[model samples]
Target: MASHRVMKIYTVSGCFPLIILLMSTMVIQSTQERTDSIFHYTYCAIHQNIQTDEEMGIADLLSSIAGDIQLRQLDLRSLFPAERFPIQIRFNLKNFDISSDAEYSIAIHEFGVIYEGSCALSGERIVVNDGNGSQRTSASLRPDDTGALFMNFIDIGISLTGQESIVGRSLVIHGNGQSDLEVKYNSTRLACCIIGESDGRSW
Candidate 1:
């Protein structure tokens, strides 16, 4: 019995270091996975009230159109110009009416104007201007049966690089998919929200 107990203790001791090393490796891997995982931002896009005459900011527009609709889970970081990193946008639409044939586009604005350039992902693309001073076209997006729009794996071309970062920009969903060159800009502004960090808060 004494010899058996000694052998058991020796075996346990011999394996202890290897077990600890494995555990430590697992912990490191978990941390790295979280760090590398794609992070996202959320926004609430609401329809603008036609009765209001006051020029309101994006925040005020959301407040005015409160209780009308809820657009959430927009990935802000994906807008950062990247070639290899494909961006995904997932959002739930609540109390909002969307036609099956109607088209829409997501526009980003910096310094109160649409950013001048374009980005392409996959075979689809979005442009701010067509270089001839014409309104740019937007990528077509469709909603699922659950009223959720999942724009997955969008590869923004080289437009969002260098001096421009999508941070502190305004994102607007327009009706009829009109760009900034619309004759009546405010008529097409469907829902608007300022890009912000993801902190489980609604904007």
Candidate 2:
């Protein structure tokens, strides 16, 4: 019995360093995965028919203007696991007309623009509408001269956990200028694209 105990102790001591090395490898892999979990999306083109809305008289003009405008990149980072603060989003536009005074807002929708069903589900808009005045002003839709709109590290006041995650959702860009509200409402949809990974998996 003494000999067996000595053998067991020897085996455990021999394997302890290997076990610790394995655990260290697992921790490193987990840290790498957590660091790389930030989601990325790219909006390429305007898929929907922008000229069909008769209520918006400038549909043709907007469509013509947006024909050259391309959403270059979108990067989204989750600040916390299930918290309602500090969700960072960045977007870059390309070939956009900087001379226009029209401002744009990005929104997350439940259904895609091509989804045919009840108008209720189709039109349900859940945007990052934190009513904090300064926060809202900071998050205001203002693109730079290079056509880059950065929602840099802003607290969007929403939980993006499990079912609340905005992945695989439809993202729409609304054209809102400092003009008539009706005009803004009518010409809201400037571009529409589904948010997906950076691996060209967008719909």
Candidate 3:
């Protein structure tokens, strides 16, 4: 009986670590898979509002069509070691009577200032360029035979998630001849639109 008890004890002790490791892996996978996403923001730019600021004009009329940004990757938002969550930005914009196929850089600014029907930008560029495994900036103005430009960014390296909230900011399009922020009064900025927040059902 003593030998049998000792054998049972040895078997249990030998199996304990394996059981614990399996449990830990299951917990990790469960935590990783439990993430969810929701669309909680909106940014709409219009042609009549933002097109007049350019020197020559990137386009005569530009407006947003069903653009969307979402607050996603719920798992990474809370972590012991902070990590970056994926930001998904989907926007559809059309510029009527565009002149060329030059590429334009898109950036989010710190402020959304609308003055005299034109978007006035201030502060910093919150999200731009490509880095951290995502393409966050630059867009091509693909003009068709009609001389109109159509721009669509669908998961092509743009997202709305940021460490700091980017709501109530400005999305500006910069032309070829200038840095995103130029001079004191930046009249060379091609287009500007205010970023707003909305629920999935409304706006």
Candidate 4:
């Protein structure tokens, strides 16, 4: 019994250092991961798109929590006028080639870009209406009656009432993992604007 006890003690003594070394390695690995995360935040600029509709300021929070990158303070005067395009072309959603005779506008929100279009096309147009007697009939994006589900296209339209509220109507946009968007309408004008926190992701 005494010999067995000595052997057990010997085994424990031999294994204790190994266990401590393993724990030290784990701590080192965790520290390295945190250091790498700090570096990424310090160097990489963050960007977000309106299609996602994610209203969280994760990018700015990351820079703050990481304590590596300096947060830039933008002047309120630098903000774009609501009447003009915040970014050149406004509400930078998916870059699309659309034409309309009516006014068109788009706004960038925390989640995504919301745009209203009421323009007419000459040949092969698609017409979208706001369902408030404001029929935006056009030759653009006129899906056939068969309703062929193109996984790469989406369309939304709203009335341009010179207000941010969508009381008149809204043509909500949804994508099917595809890479196309189309919204064309008639002589009705559309109002576009940008509404979101401009710290991390803007224009």
For all candidates in order, the CA lDDT equals: 0.40, 0.47, 0.49, 0.26
lDDT, candidate 4, equals 0.26
lDDT of 2: 0.47
* Greater-TM-score candidate between 1 and 3: 3
Candidate 1 overall lDDT versus native: 0.40
TM-score of each candidate? 0.44, 0.49, 0.50, 0.17
Best by lDDT: 3
Write one digit per residue (lDDT tens) for candidate 2, span 11-94.
567888887687668777776555444433333333442443457544333322232112222234345543443444545444
Where does model 2 exceed 4 Å of error?
1-34, 37-49, 53-85, 114-122, 127-139, 177-185, 197-203
Give Cα distance to truth, residue 202, candidate 4, Å: 23
Clashing pairs in 2: none
Candidate 1's C-alpha runs over 4 A off are 1-34, 37-86, 99-101, 111-137, 158-161, 177-186, 198-203
Using TM-score as the yardstick, the better of models 3 and 4 is 3
How many pairs of residues collide in model 2?
A: 0
The TM-score measured for candidate 2 stands at: 0.49
For residue 137, give model 2's deviation from the true position in Å.
Answer: 13
The local lDDT score (0 to 100) that residue 105 gets in candidate 3 is 56
lDDT of 1 by residue, 1-203 (tens): 11111222245678888876876687777765554443444343433423232475322221121221222222344565433332344444442334344455556544322211111111222355433456554544455554455344343431222343344455555556343323233345555544444533342
Model 3 lDDT tens row, 61-135: 333312332322233444423544445554454552345434455666778786765555345666553544554
Judge candidate 1 at residue 133 and give its lDDT.
59
Question: What would the TM-score be for candidate 4 when compared with the true structure?
Answer: 0.17
Q: Which ten residues in a row have the lowest lDDT in candidate 4?
A: 60-69
